[model samples]
Target chain A: MAKQFKSLHPIKFYRDYLNQNVRPDGRLLSKFRPVIVNTGSIATADGSALVRIGKTTVICGIKAELAQPKAEKPKEGFLICNVDLPPLCSSKFRPGPPSDLAQVTTRFVADLILNSGCIHLRDLCILKEKLVWCLYADLICLDYDGCLIDACLLALLTALKTVKLPSVDYDVAIDKKVVNEDEKKSILIYNTPVSTTYAIFEDKIITDPTAEEEDLSSGLITIVVKEKELCSVHKPGGSPISEEKLYDCIQETIKRADLLNTLINTAISEQTH
Target chain B: MNVIDDNNLLMRKVNCKLDILSRPDGSVLLSQGDTVVIAGVYGPIEVKTQKMLINKASVETFYRPKSGTPGIGDRLYESIIQNICETSLVSALYPRSSIVVIIQEMQNYGGIISCAVNACCFALLNSGIDMKFLVASASCALDDKGVFHLDPDKLLSDKAKANFVFVFDNIAKRIIASHTSGSFNLAQYEEALELCKKACDAIFDFYKTKMKNEIANKV
Candidate 1:
């Protein structure tokens, strides 16, 4: 369910804020809140991460299991992403199946995964036609103050960076002379796909829509990007956007992606030690 | 959970490694794939009596989401702790007093409430607050594919049976509070109790290490 928050209706504030473009939060439209990323924060899973963007908080975890490959993608393993916004997070959501928002988010994640090159499909394949690793990327929003896409991206990136697939262990062991039984190491991560969402309202393109802004938004475009490359894009509304606005969005995303990736990479690195 | 997660078997449950936090009186970070949850505990300080003395120490729980904000889960947590806290703690002895149980959720992949209980137990003990018999573990309904997953992360949790209600403390050991959903067959109920026992034992090991190091760190 969409959040039921209303804009503060700061008409004067907007005019002044837009002139110099200083947000009430003391940030430019392109500037995001202080971001924090932490990985290995969830012990029960193979890998986990939490990302907080200002007031928005998102958590993502990766679970890889042995499964059969798809009919077409038999050589490479498959990945599934599911997003959940529980009723507890907001009264708007009731306890039930995946909502429309979740479905969209899931699709967004799949696009991002493909576009960002976060995981190597080859490494996920355990054996040619025998075994494969089906990684389940589950994203959960504990709170939705605003800028959910950015927070989700932050969480997803860190979770991917910190995930470790256990080494394959053989049941056979030699007595006198040690033997090998096709042992394998951890799964390899290729690149990072960061999702950047921009909410448009009243001819203004807000980089990271807060709760109020999201409520009053005309439409939003969430783009998934890899290093200096566009991976996927999710624009829900049918609103006709300008080429300038689209290009502007990408430019802001490039800068934002760099910052996000750095934050997540550094956090994951710290947890390793 | 079986009713849920049926569509995508890949989106099922997995074994959880409970207990992972340095601070807090107790901590447990549970995960189900990409859904992560870090639960921390703090408190058992002085409380008010006659605030409705029920011949037991009152248990007060505060749940803070990852963003340091309060949402609807806070209500569920407050009531859950209130319902189970008395039975979990030596409430009768400290009547008119209070035991503050604060749970901070760092990330919630799914089945977080159960993980919260597990964290609460560890946190209460981590705080070195005396309690009654050990409070067992808790987990939600398992997923489809006949997989009785331990902790249903967000994906599995959202699809659980209506009455799946989240079993806590286990039957074989001791139960602080559990939904009287009355849906589970006798055998299934018994199995859940056993599962909690195993989960409890495993989590306690982590708690032991956390408490030892936390106490030592102070020194």
Candidate 2:
């Protein structure tokens, strides 16, 4: 029966593959699945990107709106990022308010954006403390395989790079702001952050675990790196991992981040050309 | 009687791909011009006791906007899609069950409601559900000069005096649902309706070709 196969086959197949030091998809224990990124695809949003890691797909759309700058952060703008995991992606989630996993993922992604400091908030300010551009990045998962954090990070970064803001003009007599659509400018990105997730099962570390692997893993860790700097090391407490394992994960994350940086740069250039 | 500087007006070409997502029971990504919609169909599986109906299946639809939280505007589209699906699908075959259709907006240059309706039909077809007849929808906009344009883009739709989205069943070529925005006189509304009915023919042809090609590729 389909039910029996669904529950038994993945466990047995994964265990056999692990014993052989490989994955069910025929990759080494530390090998990651392929990632693909497409930028500026959505017409409604000012900027958008679609990212796919293995079978996991995520779409990030960035909409720009104008609002008053916070008095405390007079020269700075704001960035709002939300991650939505609807039931269309997988059967694990139902339709309603975001589930616990979604909330956790959303917080992690928001923290990653703040800690990475890839974007300069000051640049979004049109008239300091008066009017500022508010960028809202809405990332929706269309498929749930595994490694959602990595896909979201990649999509968000690419979508930001594709954003083009219209020039604003302040009319003194009219006392109103006018947006000039003919001349547009792109946002400056200071750093490009990429995240890598690993699942630990039976003293083995698996990179880019699938949905099934995630459920079976004893612990999960996500390492975020931007160039040589470490932004965040997220381990939400399932099983304690040793320092040596953590170090190994960080090193792997650095290598992956470097590759992703180059990938994103190439995509940006390809679009511009 | 038409008045306007002429030519260079054509409907944006529509492109579609079926079964793009693996997790959904039925899925489709459909784009008309620059507007794109992704639809997923799941159902005839299980239903809660409260929602279950003894005589027929319960149908539900959720429409998500491109970004931000879904608001009252999206609910309007959801109801339209639900009604069209209820009309086309043979729910009597699966009683006490539920069928869910989730539509995600990818882009919206114009004709968004029609695009969503078309995508839902494709998703339903991909799911292999029992349907009394295949359905297709088209939107026609009438400009200030009384000229009817088929599949108008956002620029035209914004300036149009009136626009209407018509959903038609393939069997009798009768309109199953019609949604109108802006204002038009009786004669203008009838002209737009006739234009959309004729446009549906081309859309139906597109559906046939796409299915035929898919079947050919499979074998």
Candidate 3:
């Protein structure tokens, strides 16, 4: 009976649930779904992770290749983040070049990766201008439930944590790189930024929405938190939110970041064992 | 021939996961040694006017490289994969529609073309699309010592004199597609083809085992 009403009058159903301070998925208004992280799942990728938040599943694979450093930044390497929302991930996405949503998400994630200072590009440099590691981190959405940004960020961070690069020595005389397969080292990660997404349904704020809730909501806010500092607050052209509500979101994200940090560390440690 | 050993004939570790993505009709993440490719199949759906075929479904393929936009070499890979898929798929069964195959290159240690082709086949199988016959591909590298290395890594391939990729059908195991680079004599070419044919059989067996496991899980 509830399912029929949810399908017929989705907004009304959500309003009824919101009136009782609960969500359709039985989560409280501010409660996030359980997050599951698995690292080093793809052997081919230098670093890889599969993350699940509720029903949304995302896989991130980081492949490190040798490339010449850019002219301007001769000492730093490149970190490219791309998010793919294929037709297999959601019915709304079609088979073709990446959609607008995908492009935006890629840019947003790239910005967070660069601006957060989580990964030092200089650490990726091997031979200054001659050769450096170009990390291609590709995040593919396997299932689109909701809280996509949250899942993508977690997958990227965990995958980055698991990356191991084979030591490469440059022979100056021959101008060639000799990779030592026996010696491998992990990249230095400075910070682990976790993102939390919230949806504004009418006047009430709901956390970690599903696909159905995302559609019916009037606005969406994604907050990226690193430790106690706020890294980014992305509210893309939705209904205006109050300052206090936004502050509450950031505070909530700070707490969530601590929990996610522990989760990511445990996942990585489990893989090592 | 003198340098070729029995162990060299064995292909690298091949791993695959089917139906990994929920939205696509069929999807597979396949890894051949260190070269990994993810492929998704969507077919018998609405077709654009320009790409639609009256008698058969049009097959389209897009190959996305790891980092940058698809360049000339990437376009060449796309056409090669599209032709192979068109030949293997029974497109005539779904007329006035289209079958789209999208392959994303996740990692490339060596033999990426063969890995991508095999990944596409696995994705098609997972989608349960009608096909004339299943296809599997194998790659080998010819070194300066006149020896063939099956599933060469980046180190071997970079120092190789020539590289070869061959696709074969499961029914007759006949050649479906062949791509080669560098120069070699006719005898060397024949020898390389023979080497790849045997490797492709192992891929076919892998596919069968994967399908059997998938069925058992469902039951």
Q: Which candidate tops TM-score?
A: 3
Assess each model's interface with DockQ, reporting 2 decimals per model: 0.01, 0.01, 0.01
Provide the TM-score of chain B versus the true chain B for each model in turn. Answer: 0.64, 0.94, 0.96
User: What docking grade does candidate 1 earn?
Assistant: incorrect
Clashes of 1: 20
Model 2 per-residue lDDT tens digits across residues A1-273: 545765767566667779999886788999888888888879889899999999999999999998888989999998999899999999999999886567657766776676566898999998877888999999999999999889999999999999999999875467698899889899999888888989878778899999989987855777777777666555543343454576678778877887888888888788889
State which candidate, 2 or 3, has the greater TM-score.
3
The C-alpha RMSD of each candidate to the native structure, in angstroms, is 20.3, 22.2, 21.8
**Recovered fraction of real interface contacts per model:** 0.00, 0.00, 0.00
For candidate 2, give the DockQ.
0.01
Candidate 2 second chain TM: 0.94
- What TM value does chain B of candidate 3 have? 0.96
Off-target runs (Cα >4 Å) in candidate 3 are B1-219
Residue A134 lDDT in model 2? 97
For B170-202, candidate 3 gives per-residue lDDT tens digits of 886755566555445546766887888788888
Which residue runs does candidate 2 get wrong by more than 4 Å? A1-6, A9-13, B1-219
Query: Taking the tens digit of each residue's C-alpha lDDT, what string does model 3 give over A105-132?
Result: 7877887776577899999999978899
Q: Residue pairs in steric clash, candidate 3?
A: A88-B23, A88-B24
User: Which residue pairs in model 2 clash with each other?
Assistant: none
